[model samples]
Target: MKTLYKNYINTFKGLSDEIWWLALITFINRAGTMVIPFLSLYLKEDLNFSVSQVGWIMSAFGLGSVVGSWIGGKLTDKIGYYKVMVRSLLATGVLFIALQFLNTFVSLCIGIFIVMMVADAFRPAIFVALNTYSKPENKIRSLTLIRLAINLGFSAGPAIGGMIITGLGYAGLFWVDGITCVLAALVMIKVLNPKKAKVLDELKNDNPVSVYKDHAFLVFFIAMVLFGIVFLQYFSSITIYYKDVHLLSEFEIGLILGMNGFVIFIFEMPLIKWLERTAFTKLWLVFFGAVLTGISFLILNFTSWSGILIIGMLLVTFGEMVAFPFSNAFAIERAKKGNQGEYMALYSISFSVAHIFGHNAGLQLSAGIGFENTWYIITGLAFICAVLLFSLNRRLNNLKKIQL
Candidate 1:
């Protein structure tokens, strides 16, 4: 027993205090997401908004996210993650509090957009901090683990938000988010200590030198934008499929949707370790994983078995766990030293741009082409997107060897 106890304590003796703070910041930042995952339902069921109206509102939030990422990049370059994070959290909390007083659609929409602005901006700031905190020896794994923390919070936040909505209501969800935001601000204020930059260097801050001019970062950014379109479908296309099919009870649909996050939680860490070496190897694992995900949409249409649908969602989890971190890690790898904020923000734009199309067009495509066929089309398109990305990778590999 003594030897076992000593071994356990020995395991983490030299662990970086910085990583612990990163994890804590992650927990605090993500706890605010308790409101977002339930946002669709809250708009429709709680506030009696129409489906189209809901989509419009969601687009507003996405817009906020884009502006947030852009502003965060400039500001993080200007100041640092510490001030950006504190202000973002505090502002998000105030916006959530404002939601409690509004009943009008425009009121809710604008409020939600404002809140999303701050919430979304914090994301790149976080990516910047985490990317800087590690050496190359462990940066990929470090990035993977931090993403895992966010998903872990996202997995539980919805269920807990659901319970609160049931027990107390939408008002309750806001209160939960508001409380978390304030707490996150406090935690960041006290614990997220970053190394001070040289004063002269800080004073001369100009436009972040284009890391993209270097080829690897540019090609990776292009590929990530394509990947974004494929990945954004879960919330946009798949949910629409579930509702349009009407093949299950509300409870059943909830379970199916809920299972995606569940599988992500189960597989994320183990798979993160597995993919770390693989991404350094052939790079096809990431490609194959994207194929699995795109095909799973088509599979969901053919199967009625609960088991198959669950399995299909598992494939998405598998694909997601593979592609998402690697994509981010790939970006971080080629980013300019000390410009993790701008790199992450630029990377984030791909996801935002992808959704700009996915959210606005996905539903209309499903409506026009039929939901089943839309999956077929999407699967085909996903392959094309993947091909584009891989093509970029091949073209840029020679250039990548130049500096990085």
Candidate 2:
């Protein structure tokens, strides 16, 4: 028993202290991520906004994310990660507080945009910080650790936010979220001291790599965007399909969605560790993961059994577990030391685009065609992406092996 326990403990050993602190910061911030998860509901219930209005407001958030990502990458290359992290967190916290006062549609749209622009900027800074603090070999595990914290916090956030919404209302949600962001910023300031680090000084002197010129990375990025558009259907379309087609209640759909995070929390770290020891390359894992994701959605067309939905969720969760960390690692590997921020920023544009394309396209297609047909479309797309990403990964790997 002791031997087994030691083996488990060894799986998580060797990450730097900075990575641990960053995990804590991520946990704290994400645990307060109640606003976005419930934004549409709050708009509809409290402010009496129409569905279309709520969607437009949500799109504003996605647009803000694109702008934020671009700026965050640019600034991280200039001023360094610590300053960007602190400023973005504090600024976002203030914006969240301001959001409660903006009741009109136009005002709410502007508020959401500004709030997300500040908040989403945190993503690139996080990748830069991780790459800055961690060793090359430890990069995947380090990224996975932070993702674990995020999933854990997300599991807690919506449940806690539900109670907050029930008791203190939407205003209370904003207040709690804002306070947490400010606290996270304070913790970041205390933990990370830029002036003391020589490595950061060196990075500060290096030139930023332009993602636009990297045609190979651009291909990988496009593949990710395609995969994201399908994978993200779990967020936008899966529950609607559950509610409408399967006739599941809201509570059941929430439970199924909750299951995705729970599975990732339990499985992701250990799986990544195991993969690190194996001969299977990251590209192969990603290819198979995409294939599995397609199969998960395709399964729905064959059966109406609710039990099958759980299986589909598990499959998709595992696919996410396999693909996302390596995708980040691959992007990081392609970047030079000082250019991590730019690569991650450009990489993150995939998610931003997925937000607009995935949700809107998935829903519209489901409405226009049928739910089963929608899944088939996503299934086909996932396969196409898997093939494209696999071929691209091979080509990039050969070229970069000599350069790296």
Candidate 3:
């Protein structure tokens, strides 16, 4: 037990103080993320929108994210990540509050689009900041550390969010979410003073290769989009599935979702640390993670018992712990070869694109064919994504050998 405890503690030994502060900021922001998880339910239950309408609004959110990520990437390269991060957070906070007032379909779509555009700009900027703050060797672990903060906050957020929804109603969620975004920005300004922090030099090329022309990366981009599509359902269609199919309450649904975060918080860092020491390549780990995610959804079709929900969530959580940090590290490493901001932005864009397709597709499929069929379709997509990643891994290995 002592040896196990010491090993877990050792996983956190080398990250910089700035990285810790970044993680704290992420925690503050994400802990208040009560809205997104329950947004579909809000539209359906409170606003009386159809599943199709809710899907379109979610798609608009994705469209905004793509635009935001592009603009953020360009701005990060020109003006610096610090300015982008602070402004994005502040603007997003205000937008969240404003978002509460929109009731009609068109208005909510536009409102959410605007809010997400401002909000997602933070994604690539933060990635660039991570590059600045962390040593190359510790990058994946640093990503995992930040993810741990996100999950820790997420674990707390949903339970609290559920209570707020029950006691104060959905409007309360908007107010709290907005306030937290503002608070996180303030914390970032106070602690992560860009001028005072040490900046690592990224790979320098006088004539850097454009990310657009990187064919291998483009394949990986496609795979990421597929992965995002399969994974994002947990936030959208799956919540409704829990509520409608299993007859679970909002708070119960929140607890199940919160469990995903709690599991990651306890185990992900140590898992990543151990995996890093093994001979298995990062891409191989990602492929395995994808397979596990597929299985998580596939198993849902086999059982009607609510206990199955817990088991499914556990499987997906472990898959996420294995997949996301390494995938992020891979993107960061590839970005080193070209324009870092652009590469990372495209990386973020893949998810945005997935958002454009994933949520709507999941909801529509579930509404039309039923949740069982939707799970089967999602399972198939996940496996396809795994196959794509495996191919990408082989290609990368071949390229490395050629370079040698």
TM-score: the better of candidates 1 and 3: 3
Per-model TM-score, in order, reads 0.84, 0.89, 0.98
RMSD of each: 4.3, 2.9, 1.0
Q: Give the TM-score of candidate 2.
A: 0.89
Supply every candidate's count of residue pairs whose N, Cα or C atoms clash at under 3 angstroms: 0, 0, 0
Query: lDDT at 368 for candidate 3?
Result: 98
Candidate 3: regions farther than 4 A off? none
Maximum-lDDT candidate: 3
lDDT per residue for candidate 3 within 1-404, as digits (tens), equals 99989988998998988999999999999999889999999999989999999999999988999999998999988898999999999999999998999999999999998998999999999999998899988899999999999999889999999999999999999999999999999999999998787775455567878999999889889999999999999989999999999999999999999999999988999999899999988888989999989899999999899899999999999999999999999899889778888999999999999889999999999999999999999999999999999998998899899999
Candidates sorted by lDDT, descending order?
A: 3, 2, 1
Q: Could you tell me which 10 consecutive residues in candidate 2 have the lowest summed lDDT?
A: 197-206
Candidate 3, residue 119: how far the Cα is off, in Å:
0.3
User: Ranking under TM-score, best-scoring first?
Assistant: 3, 2, 1
- Model 2 residue 384 lDDT score: 89
Candidate 3's displacement at residue 90, Å, is: 0.4
Cα-lDDT of candidate 2: 0.80
